[model samples]
Each structure stands twice: as structure tokens, then as C-alpha cells.
Target: MALTKKGEFWYGTTSGDTQAELRSYSVANEHEASRFAASKCDCGCRTFALQSDEDAGVAIRTCTDCGQEHLMGDSADHLDDAAPETHECVCENEVFELMSGVSVTPGTHDVRWYYIGCRCVECNLVAVFADWPCDAGDAAAFLAKV
Candidate 1:
């Protein structure tokens, strides 16, 4: 029998849109990588892993091995978990900036990137966000106390 490659692995760009640790290929196959991408972001911007190669470099949430990609980040109103996910995004766009609001999602942790709003040519959109807190309790307190 030929050696059977019976597993899933994923590879991705080392560059992230957020300030969190730039996640590279974590597993041996594609399946796991897709899972990792869907599990929210460090900056609360949600993730959907992509596979980029030299030819088709940097497609969104796309897997080069399986040719399957996920294109997300249009909406900004869901919390899947409390892992304190943050967002890394492009500096320029047509609409809003930041991820969420400090009021709705207080700046609890030091390990997050507060969306300071963006300078779109036509409009500057301000969003809200939060992620894994450098001080989880302090963040929670700030959210609760005020």
C-alpha cells in the first residue's frame, strides 16, 4: 500500500490585520486551519482562515490545498466566545474603523487594539471591539463599574 496521507493541515500568511500574534500555519492539513479561522479574532473582528500561495497570493480566508476560502468581516455584532479576540484589518476602507465601541465593549485589556476610527475619503466610521484582556477582571470592572 502507498503511504497514505490521512490528516488535515493548513497554512496561511504570517501577516494579520490586527495587533495580536500573527498566526501562521498551525496544523498539518487544511481542515483544522479552517476551524481556527472561524473561532473569532484576537481583536474581536472574527476570522475565517485563508490559504495564500505565491501565484494567488493573499486571498481572503482561502485554502490553497482545498481551494476553499471564507470571505467574512462585513458585520460586527456577534460574540462567539470570551477569548478576548481582537481584530487586525486594513488601514484604509470606505466605511468604519476600529472594531467595536469602548462603551459596548469597554477597553478592558491592555492587549487589545482600540479602534480609533478610520479616515475614509467620504466618511469616517467608528466601530467597537474587545479582546482577551491583559487584565480580564479590570476590563470587566471597567465595563461594569461605569
Candidate 2:
């Protein structure tokens, strides 16, 4: 399924009104993607905020209801010797909602490209934090694998 939400929000620093609007967009984006990669918190909440460190190939999802966090994507074993750093929005908020865009071949399940992004819960700034060329034959499995 494609993105089902739309509004007049930009993809950068946002005001209170635009922030809320973008959050709605993010929630919808997450829901659509769930058809491929379903996830839920222990609290039974399906909504979550997301964050990631591209260098570490790590993505984190935080439950919106109970504040629990889950790690997405692959392990950070490759970054065992890397320095630690913090990733936060300009608003100083570490919480965000995950959004993604995937391009699959027509009439087939193969995926050609994938882009994962984060929308700040505080300021609603949206950005594609990670993306890569893909040759996945199973779109759903690929999304889940990421």
C-alpha cells in the first residue's frame, strides 16, 4: 500500500501546527508499512517513535504509549570499536516516528530501492536518515529484514 496521509507540512523545522500535522502523516506512514513489517509494543500499542544511527546501521523504535524502545535493522557488531555519540533533533528531542519509501518492480515483488526516514516528534522535521540500493526478491521480507 502507498502512503495514505497528506497535509500541507514541509520537511524541516516546523511550527506547532505543522508539527502535529506531520505527526499524523508519520503515523499513517507507519501504519501502511506495517502490512509488510508488523510490530507492537508489550502495552499492545502499535504506534512508535523512531531514531537511527546510519553509521551504526541501527534503527530504534520507541513505543508511543509506554515509552519502550526496540532496535530495528541489523546489529551494531561492526561498530564495536566506534565512538559513541548522541543523535537528537534541533529541538533536543530523541523521539520520532519512522517513515519509509520503497520502490518495487512493476508486477513483481522485487524491491529496487528503499529509504527509511525519521520524523521528529517534537519539531516534526522529516529526513531520510538511511537508504540503499536493494535487490530484494521478497518485498515484505526485505522490509522486515531492515
* TM-score of structure candidate 2: 0.50
Tens-place lDDT digits, model 1, residues 77-142: 222321222233234332222211121223224212111112121222122122221122233333
> Candidate 2 — worst ten consecutive residues by lDDT sum?
30-39
Cα-based lDDT for every prediction? 0.22, 0.51
Question: Once model 2 is optimally superposed onto the true structure by TM-score, how far is the C-alpha of residue 60 displaced, in angstroms?
Answer: 3.1
Residue-level error in angstroms, candidate 1, position 67: 0.3
- For model 1 the local lDDT of residue 2 reads 16
The candidate that wins on lDDT is: 2
The C-alpha TM-scores of every prediction are 0.18, 0.50
**In model 1, how large is the Cα lDDT of residue 110?**
24
lDDT of 2 by residue, 1-146 (tens): 22223353344433333334334444554422222233456788755665555554555667878988665534234345334344566567866555554556667777655556555667665655454444546677656644
**Ten contiguous residues with the weakest lDDT in model 1:** 26-35
User: Which portions of model 1 miss their true places by more than 4 Å?
Assistant: 1-59, 75-104, 107-146
